[model samples]
Target: MNPNKPSKYLTLVTEESRVEGKKNTERNPKNLRKHLSSIRLSRKLQSGIDTDFYEKITKKFLDDFYPKKCNNPSCEERILDKEISTRPDIIRCSKCHRQQSRLSYTPLMGLKLPLYMFGVVFHESFLQFPKVITATEISKRLGIEYKSALKLKRRFQLFCSDHLPKYKVLTYRALEEEYKGFKLNPDTETDVAPKMGLKPYVSADACVLYSASQRANKGRSRYRYGGLTSSIFLSPKLGGKQVGTLVHGICIQNGPAFFESVSDTKANTIGPLLVEQIPYSVPLFTDSGYPWLYNIYKNHRSVNHSAKSSEARYKLARNRFCKLSVHNQVIEGSFRLLKSSFSSYCYIKPEYSKLYLDEFSFIKTSKFFGLDCITERCFGSQFSWEGRSTGAREATVVRIGQEKYPHRRSSKETKKWLIQAIKDRKYQEPEREERLRRNKEQNKYDLNSAEAISRSRKALAGEMKRFNDFWSDSQKSKHKRKREIKYENLSFKIWNSIQYYKESSEENPTVQFIADKFKLDKRTLMIILRKWLKYGLIQKRKLFNKESHDKRVDFSIVLKSDSLPHLLYTQLPKNKKIFRRMDQ
Candidate 1:
């Protein structure tokens, strides 16, 4: 090699490593050591990781986890300052002249790594990139040890399970007015499923839950399997790779939906999801396996479960969905898509089953929801699954403390850590207010303290109102003077986008996809697209007459009675989806 030429492994080695040269020895292996020491990987990672961003996030997480005033009743400190120590981030109590380990009181405590590196690990784990990543692969890319990467990976999995959101009920009234019209009750008894209630263009189903780790254990019983009942929706109006399904509530791509570990196909396990999630007004094109026409949902028994007719009696109660055009194709496709979404190791252990489910949920929804949103949602959570007084952190911290005690080289590290961490935690023990907040989060929007839910809904409603107001205002003028131009413009934008999606290998981009792309209202955009693409909406002008007003007619109302399905799907006041009265 030339004297001035850089080494081929220069990218992999750090400045210090280069200076040390081969004579100093590479950090390849030290099999005799019980645990491998962190090498130049930390420095390399630090250089790559955005320290400032991670620091801010760490501070935010710490503030949310730990309390102010040293958490010590006797301490006079009002505010804590974050400083770097052996633990990376510790809150120093000015008055007590003591410090509290930031991550020590949370799930992220222990498993030595810098806060910035931890942040990087978290940031990368939640990311939907390369579509195939393992701890080994991550270790190589992040320049960290495989074990550390694996630990981080496991922590993320646990984190996902622990902090999975208790989603707000997607009520009928809460749905956008546009989608509300399409949401139909599938109950055949109450005349709910109209002759023409069709919303989903196509749908798929996936109902199996298995893991590699779980299967590897021979003693693992078949009964231990988790039942993942999922539905994937392809929006009718949106063409070209536009699909949304119920994950939690709305399908924001890799969205987390109603998930449970139950095996039996009973109403109790599936009712809440069907009623709250499924577009009840919209015809669900499910397969023959789930021909559940009507289910007397828990907390929603107003619709007489006495059976609509012989057909209704034969269907829902019997689990007989025979002889239907709809198949489990969409969900089946989704399931296949899901399995392939992961790399080689597709199995998960039974212990972290729910967490694994939650992970898949977010992964699937990531396409629509965006990785940033998923990451924020995953991290901001308090990991409430364990049901502790202060939510997940309390239990997680305790577990971590116990786990780390054995990992320490001697009593010195453990004792020093315990003094600061345990003392701070004990001082800041959850009070009545903290407990109440936990309860609120755990139970979600209950009857008595519906305030939180109401507030959230109000916030969402305000956002929707603002969005609608802006579009509505624009339409108010365009509805009359430039309706045709509006139609043409929207048509061009929608169809052009569809073509673009197809050209980009998204063969069937949904109208929702287009609408989402343009930030236009789905209802409004779909309506225009229908007129232009399907209903022959054209603005005819007199030959060479610049001043002549084009002759065009609004064809939106014509479809209101065109067909039974059209009538059912129409926007008429009478056709509007009716919501069940609020529970007393």
Candidate 2:
């Protein structure tokens, strides 16, 4: 082959073929149908003349609010649908003369928008489901104010958040059908057997919603004067800051998922949350970062994403018999979809982060239950007007009011009342002065009494005694000295054990082995190992098991070259025997 020419392995494509491929991708029917459907829906909503949409929404409202029979016991007449058609908002019984407002006691109690327009907002919000439609887009489509559209959208999300179910699981047959060729059912009884007491595979992980510059001013003063002030300086790197809200998610394969905003990703925080959200019998899948899960759950498994090829081969062989893969890719892909849905918003505030998470979680749970977003389960019975009052509705509506002197008193009457009040105040001044002077004299006499003086002196002496005792150096120093001696003795014993291990075996000793030999707590030994590793006195190496072929991680401690010279020179009596046994 010529050195300058293209090799046989490499294939070159012309610009014409590249353009043709692009055209073919654009001409795909599925893509065309999606875009066209969205456009048609938006157009129909914006036109505001869809009578069928209005009728459908009105029928639903009537069905939710209409009583089965008339409220009057004497008549016992059933309210027919024809009698309810004159007014969409009010349902009337023809015989009993009873009337009811359709929106009363519901979420739409005092909705100001037209019935059809409200239907449009509802269709865009819940009917669309997982696809995010922002309030800005809704406002543009409905020709409404941005604040109105935002309030409408928030109301729907709040309803879903309050009513969404918890910990929904799919049937084994459903799971098997969805994930073909996977042995999800552990029971050998029957295909239609309930999944009760069976362990389902769950994947848990944490992800960031979005990142923002920590140095950015998140206050009203940033835009007070219509522009940024010169006194406030911002660094080019934004103070080397990247802040985001941590959200933890648990996803079941072909089933429901749960997400919540978390303050920290520590073991204590995540461990309790996982136990609360997931059942104890389920199998958990996560990455190697969550080693603590092994102790908490009985069926916990994880994959070493950062392992070398040899470690990966061992993991593969170890997990070859598992019913499900050992990776957490299910929840990882869920995080990607969640962040993509959140891309419609510029930024989500940490305070409102739970609402967004709950909204997404509700949608996922609804899909698992085979429920539509617009069904009565989400909108009708779940929504209430409890906290919302008539005053709140009145506050949103603008009205003209009296500008000045709205009270009953006229301007001349108010002046006369003020004069009378001033005269009354002057008349009582002399009596007020006498009373205040007498009280002051009484206070002075009380303070100078014998009992008061003695009480103050004793309190001062007690305070001084407590202060001296606290500041005394003898007690604190004695305790400090005792602690120092104890710590030094413990440190010496730990170092001696480490030196013994170094001499007895050619291979580095594992932390567990050393802890077992010295009869030390594993956590305390780990702390000491961490300190030694930080100081460069020892190095840590990951070793795999060849005897049992298990995937459990084992870390061995190796003495650094520079620190080996400083180890204890004393040798143990059993060192020779241990070395010979290891050589065998």
Candidate 3:
């Protein structure tokens, strides 16, 4: 049935219905495509106006992805053309006689466009548009109205957001399908990623993004949440698809951890934040900003650079050989580059930081995998959106210039600019005298300084051992502090034990718990408790109304460790009187 034709239920398109016909097969009864020869196919392919080809693609997509059986909630019957009496393309279920269109139960069920057109639009949406292809390109490629093309692009982008997370699994499936049955040649490029790309030790750093909603022409400036902070971990020498590619993990949290509330990134809050991300088995390479990492993990390396000037820190990092032997240079450089990209995304909401971080993560991972600047596999459909207000792409339009493609300029452009600069007598370029001197010095070592280089390497290795010793020695003070608390008096231990007893609702604290805490025998603790109770300083209640059972103490009488000792010393009599009272 033509959607434009007059319907029994409501008014729509002005076209009238033709004679209703019965169908008997799945493919079209007219064989509308048998006449399309090879020459005509080639011409239509060039002309970009082939209804028959698009229809074939649409039909194939529907058969593969959509439910062909009855879509009615109560029915479970196969739909065949013979059952469809009115519409040839639409079928009725054999059991319920309910009409079932190809778009039934899908988001496109009530759409006015032909199934083929919508199929192309959806395919483009998921695979091509917004990033790879624009609305203008889509309209030109599909040979559709500009309005229709723009609308389709928007609708498809929204749909992709709904199914965005599935793209990862789908991308993996696609890779497998593309390489299925091919022998593994063990090439260095592909083998490198698996072997060297999986790094355990990684450098960590964070950069903030100031992005905002771009819906209005000029949106509000202040968001309740602060700017987005992206904490990135980079492993440059990790196993990758290529020999030298890097892999990374990221977190968006504790934004603007300075001058903020308790939840911000302080030592106490940062420990829990980073400990959960890094596994215990992996060593952490960080700066002293994360001091708690030393306590939280078994293996970690941090260099104290906060006291040093920025230039001094840079010089220290550039040395390549250091006493600490731990550097965050890789992640530090990444943060610097990432900060430059934040200019285009200056108004980001703090809560949506993770989503924004994922965009960068995908781009970097794509480079690692040698995926040519495509974002097809960045998102997966398995995850749920945080809320309804999100998912509208924050960056609908971004200006890509020299900032994005800094190295894309050709030699001609460089020479042109240089010649122009010289003619204008503007010496803006840096003097290469120091750089040439370093290169000359390095080349001499490259030629015959092997013995000197080896000696220097050994000396540096020895320095690393010294660094480790210093690091280990620093932990002794921390250990001493821990021991001081562990040796507190029995009264203090009892007060701590009583706190546990008061907090628990079910299993009451046992007599043995207090004894174990203070390293005292259970009998001695009981004797002390019995003496206290006899002196009218404390009281005990019968368990389950049984006089022969366990006893419960009145926690209020001995409130704190300081007060308990004062009461005992002031009210109790001398030891000779205590002994006489005990004997009696």
- RMSD values for the candidates in order, in angstroms, are 21.3, 25.1, 26.0
Full-model lDDT, candidate 3: 0.38
**Two-way lDDT contest, 2 vs 3, winner:** 2
Window of ten residues with lowest summed lDDT in model 2: 563-572
lDDT of 1 by residue, 470-565 (tens): 333433454442453345334443443444354456455554445556777856654554333332222211223245595432221111111110
User: In candidate 1, which residue ranges exceed 4 Å CA deviation?
Assistant: 1-81, 84-87, 93-98, 129-132, 142-145, 168-204, 209-285, 297-330, 363-584
List candidate 3 segments past 4 Å from native.
1-47, 71-97, 124-131, 143-147, 165-316, 319-584
Best by lDDT: 2
| Best of the two (1, 2) by TM-score | 2
Q: Extract clashing residue pairs from model 2.
A: none
State the lDDT at 356 in candidate 2: 71
lDDT of 2: 0.51
* lDDT on C-alpha atoms for all candidate structures: 0.39, 0.51, 0.38
Each model's number of backbone clashes?
A: 43, 0, 22
Error of 3 at 396 (Å): 35
Instruction: Compute each candidate's TM-score over C-alphas.
Output: 0.41, 0.44, 0.31
